[model samples]
Target: MFSPKSVSAALATHFGNALVSPAPSPLTDEERRMFSRLKILLTEKEQGLIESEEEDEEALVQESGDSDSDYDAEEDEKPEQRSRKPWTKELCDKMLEFYRSKDLEDGRRGASQSFKRMQNRFRAHMKTEYDLTLLRKYEKTGVIPSVRYSAMRQLASDVRAKLGEKMKKGVPIHDTDIRKIALDLNKLNAASGNFKASATWVSKWKVHHRIVSRKVTKFVTRKATKDREKVLKQIDELRIKFLAVVRKNPGIVIINADQTGQVKEMHSTRTLAEEGSKDVVVEIESKSATTHSVTVLPTIYLDGRQHPIVYVHLGEPTGSLPAKKAVYGNKNLVIGASKSHIMNREAAARYFKEVLFVQPMPKHMLLLLDSWSLFLNHSFIQGLVPKGHKVTILNIPKGGTSLAQPLDLCYNQQWKCVMRRLNDAILVHDIDFVLHTRDNLLRCISQVYWAFGAPMFKEYRKYGWYRGGFLTTHPAPFVTPPKYMFGEGSEADCPCSEPGLIRCPYCKKAHCFSCFVINSHRCA
Candidate 1:
């Protein structure tokens, strides 16, 4: 048996050297017992280690050298013995023949899933063993030519013959017609395992010819000078009417209203002389500046008031929004901006809260506007109108705003006044701010006066007169000067001399003359 202090020191020397040594403590009863047990276990293990091998040093070295020699021999034999898979002509022919024999249930017989799987397997196997250079050479030399071409040849030729017959009958071959013909040929090839290459070539030729014909037609159809001017004038008139309506109804939102600002390039001539030339060579060069075009759409609310609702569209167009222009080019000429409807819907809600609903309420706001798709839809309008406010939407008849809206009549006058004011402001203040400020003020005043003043105030005044409401003999407080006198009687009639001759006190109607009162006494 070992002493506890000697055993602890020996254990520290063997195992605790790898770790930080703990502070020395005097052994209590439990600590003394645990240290005694650990000492016994350590002594037993140490005796076993001392009794074991220090005898096989030469044998271990000889065993490691033999293992290394065996590993080298295995490495040397691996390349020669490894199997290599090659894509031969036999594999390509077998795959092609299988597809040719198989009658696919689906119309897509040529590129069936089974056929694709086989093709993919072939490609993968080839890629693993062969270089891309070998594959390209095989494809070019027809050693492993794609069977898809041979399968499509006869059908292509048949389609070409049909198209040629149609052409001989004076039927113009359109791109769509050519595409349909090509598709038909492809389907035939899939079914019959053969298509003519000539059909593909003929279809392409027809498409090219059709495009050339269209270009020639477009060039020939250039409007005469007078007709062009007339069209331009019409466009100007439409623009003027459009602006007028927009001014009257600020609620009528037009996206991309700002014109594209592009400056024209200036061309100058320069003289050039060659060293051996008798006469100086003159070259005409014209540099045209690039002009960017922005598409502008004038939209109006079909209904004057916005509803309290919104709509979200998912997926492609159905019938909700119609195509504006005919598809003429290679790609679809989608006129409206991508996500414009979403943006416009957002703008409508913003404008309604920020501008329209900001005003004092209970007044019926009649918004006169056009019927553009963006505004005509109920979802957009619903989001615009505030709750509990009376919003009346008045949609102007299609193409009739010029004759109907007062703003149209007033635009030229307003524009002239604006231009004059701008000139005056520029001269007096030497600032452009005046023009914007004054123009905005004028437009605001004009719109307010025209829409509200004329229809509500002026019309109500006339209505009141017809209903025998209090007729003003003298200028009323609210009514402007040149006071409205609403009576059959003239100024010569005296109320005192002929009290009965005077009209009723309440409405001042001569029909109810018996109710006339002067100085708080009823007429007798």
Candidate 2:
């Protein structure tokens, strides 16, 4: 590939100088090095390996003028930018990869991620992107580890085939699962001791195989499958009825309420780390956190108003708080309890009698709720309400919550995102507060819900109403809270005065990754 005109002329000058020297004269070091280079050029030119014009003895004499220094300077660098410490570790960030990003989502990641993070603070690493690019080149040349280019191609092919076979068998495919197979194949191919599956390589394999990450949350029943058209008809009917109710009481309070179990650990799967960094470690309060559960019923008001979540824990909601943070015991959430760590009929009835019934609620209202077993008991509910209060209950149809419920559109996901971020922050900062405990979970949920109800999330509320077939007008200029939260939309700095780069899902204010994780992140 070295066919520069200057380089060809420089080589001719070296040969001419050597020929003109006295007979039997020993060659100088420079002349000897130039002759070696000249010989390589001649051999390649004859083999048609280079595109440069062929030069004979006369041509060498005619093309003289350039010096050896100019020849060395004019030579283009080799395709490899700089030698990397051969990829010796496993995992995506540090491993060799070949991700072909075609779509905006993937392409935005570029050849590498944009930011670098450390345990203490955010540090800017300028050459990481360049390293990522070089890693790709090394992968192509079979200079990475000991496996050749042909062997890698075969490994990819084998992994893809294995994925298909597993999918056909109804087995789940996880990101780590891909690495497991690659490691096995690497051993089979006799790869060097440094071989590790690059996270990027897995991504490239995913892209090439048309695979994407997905959560499995739903299943089809035989009866539903057989009566698919009937099910569709039913869904349409439910939507029509729900929209009618919305139209009927335009000014009345319409509350969409449902309960969900909180992720015991509450850690986010995503995090910011130094690009090309291996083994990002995230710690949590305890593994037992995932074993216990707390129930929360978050509601979305029609007018983007705030509401206290009704949270439940086992026994009574009681626990000790740090002396410095005793405000956690305040009325941020309506806390209740049950023997099974959820609201049962008895626990719910008691909560209604002691907490909800005592509130000065609107005289006339409509409640949109799911068909929880307890909610289906009309007699029990009617007996608890005051005689004059006009609280109409409209139960969301069975299996209709997925489509007909307003909060399901996005608000629930956003709420969870807030908690996930906070939970991870707790672990990252090593806060002593055990979040899964009844008292601490109550306090955190209260803080999160307070943030969640902010006016910044008004669009999220409107989005749920609009997408769930309840809104007559378009809620334009709104964004999905979860996706938007991941962006650098915050205009302020973190409490620590760093430039904000990530927005709080609930507060919609940006904070640098360090402040968000290390410092206590709360609504300002």
Candidate 3:
């Protein structure tokens, strides 16, 4: 435990000459604040010392009070007899006049003009010459600085208000504008000259103040917007009319077709890395021209039916390609090739006649597609007229496929995502595997079709054709199809080996028609 002596020694060491000597007189504004705090500390610590000093003063005051109490009481009774003068309107007006005189000098409206000159003049004139106690007190009101500070603060606030207005108007505030604001603030404050208004500083300020700087992303042109609106309105009107026609026709079908490109090696969408590491390099398989791509055409019926995907590969189609005709009469998915690897008019016509037309053609069909030149020819339209099916080609708005076309918006993304995953898995598992090889490529494309099509059918059911009332049946050739079948029905029961004969439409599984009708819609 520390004795009182030790505590005193410690206090003495801390306070030093401040304890022994009196505080300096006529203190400046800052010093006066320190003096007041010191007085409080002394009052708490040295109460005994203060009582000793006040003893003589208290005795003298007591004696004087005995005689002067009655006189003082009388003076208090008449309040008007007070020595100090109260601040009258006349005195306030005089001080205002002095301030305004300087304020008006050279048209100085901003707070950058010094208020100290007027303050000093007011104090000197009132104290020495007039000898009038206008305020009747000697306390720091900080009136001049307070007024000037408010003015300076208003300048910054105005800047903020202007910035808010600009943002609301969608006018971007650049770095130069921020610098100008800072410069204005410096000018508004009489004391400060140099202010940091660097672009980095402005960025920090914006974030700290919760002022978001959002970049404007450009999308559709004005003309494109108008065209899209016009096209969509037309589609909506025609779709309603088409539904009315479909109510009478049971075999009517709504179909959407779009093409997507598949790359051999897909770049990683996301990857794992240590925090704060910058340069991350992930090595991929050896680059080849074949890694570029191949085109695929995916067709979907509103009844949630997806046709076998037609792959358009580079170079000529060879014997290595999957056979056109399976053991069954129906043709399999037509995998064709061209020099450019794109479906030309001939390929497009073949796809229409071979794969699409080979299926049971609906009585009245609506084919929703993008504005591809291959499907717009007179020959293509005339060919459909001869068939019992009335095929209507409704073109989706140009540059609006991503938004309007269900195939482009939904199936294409899902297809590519599945293909990417499969390709990545294959590359990771068997490093030597070449995806562009005939068998591997065929297998990969086939997996993309079947794997993506199953789950996709469910989504289409919920979102597409059935909801739109395009077809009466649920179109579950994949679901209701049988797993096994008797082949050419011989005495020795033989399972069907024909590819097209035993394929489920919904899930794309191998099942015969009898099993499909009996089991009916076996999902996945």
Which predicted model would earn the best lDDT? 2
- Per-residue lDDT for 378 in model 3? 42
Every model's TM-score:
0.21, 0.49, 0.42
- Tens-place lDDT digits, model 1, residues 81-109: 11224455876555454434455576444
Each candidate's lDDT (Cα)? 0.33, 0.54, 0.46
lDDT of 2 by residue, 23-86 (tens): 3334456655665776676655554344432211100001112211111210121222222233
Candidate 1 TM-score, C-alpha based: 0.21
Please state the error at residue 235 of candidate 3 in Å.
Answer: 4.1
Displacement of the residue 115 alpha carbon in candidate 2, Å: 30
Better of 1 and 3 by lDDT: 3
Against the correct fold, how does model 2 do in TM-score?
A: 0.49
| Higher-scoring candidate on TM-score, 2 or 3 | 2
Off by more than 4 A, model 3: 1-228, 231-241, 244-250, 289-292, 308-332, 384-386, 430-432, 460-524
Ranking by lDDT: 2, 3, 1
Residue 345 error, candidate 2, Å:
1.5
- Model 2 residue pairs with clashes: 92-199, 490-510
**All-Cα superposition RMSD per candidate:** 39.5, 26.7, 38.0
